[model samples]
Target chain A: MNRLFVFCEGPDDIRFFEGVLKSELREGYASVELIAYAGMKHIRVDGFIRGIGAMGDDYLMVADIDSDRTVKAKKNRLKRWYRELDTDKVIIVIKEIEGWYLAGLNDHASRSLGLRPLPGTDRITKERFNRMIPDHYVSRIDLMIEIIKRYSIKVAREKNRSFRFFYWKCLE
Target chain B: MRIKQVSCRNFKSFSDLTVDLDEYNILIGTNAAGKTNFIRIFRFFRDIARHGLGNAISLQGGAEYIRNIRISSDVPTEIGIIFENELGVFSGVRDTRGGSHTLSFHQIEYRFSLQIEEGGYRILEDFLRISCSCTPDLGEGESGQGELRITHTEDGVFYELSTPEGIAIEITEIIPPYLQKNVPRSGTLLIENPLLVPMPGFQRFFAEIAIYDFDPRTPRKAIPLSGRSDLEEDGSNLAIVLKGILADPEKKRRLSNLMTELLPFVQDIDVRKFMDSSIYFTVTERYGDEHPLPSSVISDGTVNVINLICALYFDEKPFIVIEEPEKNVHPYLIARVVSMFGDAARNKQILITTHNPGVVRHADIEDILLISRDSAGYSIITKPARREEVRTFLKNEVGIEELYIQNLLGL
Candidate 1:
């Protein structure tokens, strides 16, 4: 039941992005659900946070600066709620930004520059990453995928490692 | 066969409004409160979205006539309808927003933008979205916005629309292997058909869609001899339909039986055309002498019944829309007519708009709607009469006739 959901501002956004991503990702990823609502003015982080119950799995959500309201406040509020509710279950991305800046980070291009250095994850190659980053047509989905993969691995590693094993080995 | 919701903006008497719906919508408001206008707007948007910009716009007299006579262009002329498809469940929601959002339920979302330009109305944009989902957590799947994914079958294409953006990559391509060879014809979603929005291959994609207005003035004509059968908006081709029915005696017998059950007076339909200018039909009675009933001489009630039957029995469309079904029909038959619609709608989506209390009362309360007007000049559609304060008046103080009179008088 672990499904991925992508929310866009308009129907065209949903259509265009899905078309582009479906070609890049494998068949399983093609089933990712995209929802589009027009003239939507709210950035309620809880809408996505509350959405996790139905997913029963991890989620990667992307929202853009469609409203004139405080992007930072909205982003921070959502991040706080998501971390409070399910720390590793949600990933929020905001685009159409003046510059790419993931919340809680000060460096501009370190992650946002659309670089993929990891091996075996050619799925998010640097070329495709750079290709999707510049224009307003669609945000860098490759990078979005990368961020999701990284968090997914981190969550898995933390979950699988046991501290008692190290203590038991030292005592023996 | 119910209108579940309606929203209107910059339309006749509405500036901006949204109303939820029920099985039978009893649109009540003071005189000139915009009930019929609200109803017509639903069909108008549907016509434009299902058909195309040209057809949708043409129905309101003309482009010039479609412009809001009372409001400015600053407010877009808009309307939306939410109703049950063939199933007892709600199926889709449509609006004039130039965008559509499909839900996980067996529903579709359509939107169009209408604006006044150079003293005429023009569609700025149009979109049609349908919903699909699998068993476990289909809600997320159904909320997709994308091009409809189609499975071309022997009968027709089986369409599954992802979110308007298109299908995602994560979900396994679950279609049968036999259906994999067909390549999607690109730009198919942008074509305009007279009956539906510009979805590629409309006939192949949505041949199951039908519309019946129950109008007696100009009934729908049937396809000619040995022609493919289709339900016309007006019930004109009753003879052609009869001919088609007669050609297949098995189906003809079933039609005869259904007719007998519904209308005991009807024996069998006589198919004929006169003067090459008009097609006419007569009813053969079981006991008395047979008589010709000129298409013109036939009562509106009979014409409406024939039209409803053509839509219910003959047509194979998956979606059927009925407007003002109570018009010209006897109140006692409304329940039977609704039951027939329900039976026919088993495999298709059925949408209806009406204001008759007899019709409303016979329907399950969940199917009833109370359409009212708000101060902001919007039409507010709601369900479960008990939810609204105005419902009390209908439940206690006034009769349906008074409600109808008050609604027309804009009291």
Candidate 2:
């Protein structure tokens, strides 16, 4: 049986992927492992890809489209570091992972978190997401934990175009 | 009683800083970030309690060296600590059954500052205050709430005791003749006459704050059988301490189980007295034909692990400060060592400094105190858990070791 290894840029991305998408990934692989590099730039992507390849396992690299206008531009930026990177296996989060977290909340879940239901979340930055957190939540981490618990994949796919593309192309 | 807070001014790398201490604290930072200097504060207090203030200052290379180099010599070096006893209120009176009741204080705040003089140092300021609430039923006159305050000024030292009714009385009239004759000018009255402080175990608590920076070679060497049961700062008397622990069947079994769990090769450990009136421990391996290996032939890591176990388990000190507990410890066994320290912390306060990622990975965010240097080279201490970014990273399961390695903790 083949193993699927999902690499994330940081713990927030890892938590979102593991909490909401691990089962979807398990459909095509016997086992799924989530690894966080803490930050994408800190990792030597080529070495990690080769190391995982040598283990006879498939990998998915997840990143945020920070400051990049398009997925093609983001891929181009990453290509400067490792030209041989399998851009086909790369999945870019629209704007940031905070956007994906916001995308998962439906009207009821949003109101429960003391937030208003958002039509779309492609432009949600970390600062904007933090501003949306209710006063009762002690910290951003606390709000993030609650968001993961109530995350709805179907709502996320409808609210985020990049998430919809990721679901269809990779998870589906 | 346990130390709840410590403040230092112009002391080593600390110009003016205060840090709150928990039951278990882990100090993490780059080399020369003042972790050692922070631990030195405890040692300074211990020295002052055991020896006089003058000797304690000299032990750290005199007042000039003890003070922050950036600050001028005219600025007095200051150190203060607050202790709290959470157990219960203590009664100082003796019961009718001929048994003496334990004397304890609810809170103690002591602060002192000294200036570097021409030939030697002189005490510029000395202060100590203790507050306690006694049960009315304990004794006839011991029922009311009272506070004792000792202050030193330009004129002379004054001892004042106040009652719950706000009535203050000069306690100097009742001072013992011996203490009056030996009024300290170069030292604190609290250290000079701890018996006069009205609290038992206060002096011992400060004097017995054990700070260990273990050297494996010292533990490997055989020490005289007459060595004290307490583990030395360098762990030179490991055998003597282990001998005391092994005498108790319960502690010995726990130690044996821990050794086997940490060092799988070991079957048992035993101490032996040599013909030269010295003693050392030997480790029994499960498979080796040379069943019991002497301490001399044991590995440095093994000796250090044993010494640490003895220190954490056997030492009766109220506070234990160890520098770099991961030193010579294998990565695999580092978790066990840290877990042992955590378990031991429940009974007494434990503080450790570490540069090892394994140690940080196993520690809770709240237990960690990050030390960094400011632009002026003064040490700054902050709890990473209190920082918003750190909490976000940690709540998302990012290993703190990663944050430390990447310098993402914001120093």
Candidate that would win on DockQ: 2
For all the predictions, what are the DockQ values? 0.01, 0.02
Backbone clash pairs in model 1 (N, Cα, C under 3 Å; residues 3+ apart or in different chains), count: 57
* Strongest candidate by lDDT: 2
Residue-level lDDT of model 1, residues B193-293, one tens digit each, is 32232222333333334556655766434334443356566655566766677778656655665564356577667777655555556665556566645
User: Which portions of model 2 miss their true places by more than 4 Å?
Assistant: A1-172, B86-104, B138-146, B153-156, B165-182, B185-189
Model 1: residue B327 alpha-carbon error in angstroms: 4.0
TM-score of every prediction relative to native = 0.48, 0.67
**Interface DockQ of candidate 1:** 0.01
Cα error, residue B36 of model 1, in Å, equals 3.9
TM-score of 2: 0.67
Superposed Cα deviation of residue B336, candidate 2 (Å): 1.8
The local distance difference test score of each candidate is 0.47, 0.78
